[model samples]
Target: MRVEGLKLTPVSSAGIEQNASEVASGSKNFGEFLTEALGEVNQLQNDSAKASFDLAAGKLQDVSQVTIAAEKANIAIQLTMQVRNKMIDAYQEVMRMQV
Candidate 1:
């Protein structure tokens, strides 16, 4: 599955350092960060579904890949749900705040 016109590259040490600095300086909001993180998780789930289908059809050879992909998708979904719950709790707390 090739993404057209997308340049994929490993995160260099300097890039990681820059991102860390921005986060530490509060330059990136939590909502933006979580949105990007959840997008990655959604991509993982799609990939996992494809891999599992291929494995079931005997097109994929490695069972471990299927298993790992499924597990990653599961964990990502669980984490996203937890984050959503926390956000709902926070909203309720704010609504009940004595202003």
Candidate 2:
């Protein structure tokens, strides 16, 4: 087996700052982001289901691939839930603060 060195790229702080500013300025639509995230979750679940069905029908040759797909979908769902919980908590905290 041949091993290849991994190539890594450095991220610039300027780009990150610019993105943060854009987000704060409402240049990007928050609803679009949420919609895209939900769409991704839906797609992952569909893929996992298809992989499982294909495996059960003997249409898939690799069991590991199907398992990986299912795991990916599960992780995505869990992460989405955690983000949602955090958002709710943040909102509540903001509401509790008085001007």
Candidate 3:
């Protein structure tokens, strides 16, 4: 039996430090993230609507495609609504807090 030369090297300290920094500063502010997420949801809804219209007009052949798209859009909208409700609740709570 012969074993070939095997070498495994761990990540460098500088690489680890860079990765930590990236994780710490990579994300946008909460409001910006929310805005971007809502925009994505809006886009999904628009796509769903377009797919449904295409299906209705006999332009799309697969009913399943339209159904899936619609369901995704519905779920995204519901999630967005829930997030909005939570944000409102948080804001109200903060307002009620004694400063």
Which candidate ranks first by lDDT, i.e. highest? 2
lDDT of each: 0.93, 0.95, 0.91
Cα misplacement distance, residue 36 of candidate 2 (Å): 0.4
Q: Per-residue CA lDDT of candidate 1, range 47-79, in tens?
A: 999999999899999999999999999999999
> How much is the lDDT of residue 65 in candidate 3?
96
What lDDT score is found at residue 43 in candidate 3?
Answer: 95
Residue 72's lDDT within candidate 3 is 96
Candidate 3 local lDDT, 1-99, one digit each (tens): 999997988867998888678668975566787788989999999999999999999999999999999999999999989988998999999999998
Candidate 3: lDDT of 68? 98
| Model 2: per-residue Cα lDDT over 11-82, one tens digit each | 779988998998999986988899989999999999999999999999999999999999999999999999
Candidate 3 off by > 4 Å: 1-23
Clashing pairs in 1: none
Give the range of the ten consecutive residues with the poorest summed lDDT in model 3. Answer: 22-31
Which scores higher on lDDT, 1 or 3?
A: 1
The parts of candidate 2 lying over 4 Å away from their true place are 1-27
The Cα error of candidate 3 at residue 79, in Å, is 0.4
Model 1: CA > 4 A from native = 1-16, 24-27
